[model samples]
Target: MSRTTKLATIASASAAAALALAVTATPALAWTAGNFTATLNGTMTIDAGVSASCTSSTLKGTIASDGTLSITSATVDGCGVTVTPKALPWSGKLDNGVATINGFAMDAIGCTYGGNLTGGFTGTDLPVTATFANQTVNRTSGLFCPASATITAKYDFAAS
Candidate 1:
């Protein structure tokens, strides 16, 4: 073949190989926005000379693909009073089973106050149970002033 014909043949072969490689490469897995319901169950204590026990509750949210989540509601009722955030939905994100949460409102059952919470997770196994630890509960109650509770949340998902 002439030099130009040989060069053209080589270019065409290279292009075909590149196309084949691209078609065979694996695609990335994208997270989808889905409705999630998890039970937020944990412990809260006050170090008031003698440690006092406090009742705990949970909040739920919806997780989106773009790492956006929200708290739907919170329930804290054990003491003589009840405290709950008026907002039904809070927001946050989920990445690799670890959630960087935001817009969370926690209202103590006994005190007239609420706050934001941050926590880490183990992983999300649908219809299975997951555990969350190292939770930082920022309380905004005037009487209690402010407090943080080390919390562990156990979530059991309903079978899909």
Candidate 2:
């Protein structure tokens, strides 16, 4: 072969080798999930900021590969009270990353007496503890008294 032909052949071989390497070096898509500790921080305000205030607290829990999460014990403190009411039970459910609770009660020691409260939540959860923010609450007194008010709240969890 002529010198020019030999050089052309070498160049073609080099180009083919580079193309093969580029194809082989491509990365594959991967999905992985294991035990991990997650912390969620946000504000849980009531009535826009007139009733309650909370800071970025820690939420410790576990997450599985399938996104099935459960937290055993979580604590949140930054809760403020504005009325005197009988404290009620705090309970809720987490669905698809949303926190929904029926109610959470608080009393302001010597302000108004006992009343019933209802509220909703907005927050994020990574298959574990759900740390919510901007919870809105409405408190209504019994038939005879008929007093009502609104406030914010912050509570922890023992998710499972």
Candidate 3:
């Protein structure tokens, strides 16, 4: 082969290798920093001896650039009982395909429960589903409250 032809082939091979390295070295951008909203996919049930099913619930929050989730407000309605979120801002982390919420506390009919919740995230992009199944919470107060309770719910999150 001609010397000029050999030089061109070598340069082309080097450029292809560099491109491949750049693609592999780039970090995955799983989540972005922006306002987000979470809506209940169905009924949210809390079982602590006495089962209560809430028809609807909404959560509003913001995700930082570093994938830190900050829930600013959350509201649950229906089931003939009022469910109130105690903590003003609950923090968590969204990484890989998992979602975790730390220090989640709620009150209902004088009873309060608090614990950490872990769930999985489904979806590649904007709208993702967060399903928390049988997350256990211990009673923080109230004589009538059970020692422990389980909460199950699926929430769909989207950018607002």
Candidate 4:
């Protein structure tokens, strides 16, 4: 074959190969908004010195666009053995964007998540810093048990 013909043939094959590769290339996986569950930690200042820490489970919510999450309505079990954590249909945000939970407000139940979460999504645990204020209790026992108890806790948000 002529030199020009050979060069042309090689170039054509290269172009074809490039085109095939491009056509078969997979696109990047984008992070989508979805539901997730998080574990809780820290402590709940019940009253005086009577308190309960984070439980095996705490909040369930959906992933927000900003890497935070919304607090789903559910009952949190294990509150000082005398009481179960109050179930709330709370609308809260976390991870800077899990559920300080940043700007989480619950006026009807009187609770809020505290602190400022920063950085991007890296599947880290968001600690819960909440104060459940003056929760009315009717427990017949416990040193810290009061008719009205305030719960202050800091839990972690583990993405699943």
Best by lDDT: 3
User: Looking at model 3, which ten-residue stretch has the lowest summed lDDT?
Assistant: 24-33
Model 1 regions lying over 4 Å from their true place: 1-14, 40-61, 76-87, 109-130, 144-147, 157-160
lDDT of 4 by residue, 1-160 (tens): 9999999999999999999999999854333567756554544444533455435445677765554456664444555444333334344444432223333322112332222222223332333233333333333334433434344554444445
| lDDT, candidate 2, 1-160, per-residue tens | 9999999999999999999999999554221343334343355444422344544334344444344333333343565643322333333444444554444443443333223223333334323344434343443334333243344344443333
* Best-fitting candidate, scored by TM-score: 3
Clashing pairs in 1: 69-91, 69-92, 70-90, 70-91, 71-90, 72-88
Candidate 2: Cα lDDT at 9: 100
lDDT of 4 at 47: 50
Could you tell which candidate, 2 or 3, scores higher by lDDT? 3
The global Cα lDDT (0 to 1) of model 2 is: 0.42
| Candidate order, lDDT descending | 3, 1, 4, 2
lDDT of 2 at 110: 31
> Ten consecutive residues with minimal summed lDDT in candidate 1?
45-54
List per-prediction Cα lDDT, in the order shown: 0.52, 0.42, 0.88, 0.45
lDDT of 3 by residue, 19-77 (tens): 99998896776676899999999999998888999999998999876668899999999
Candidate 1, 7-107: lDDT as tens digits = 99999999999999999987653455566666534444433223333365555556565646666755655534444556556666555665554554544
Model 2 regions lying over 4 Å from their true place? 1-40, 48-51, 56-88, 109-133, 141-160
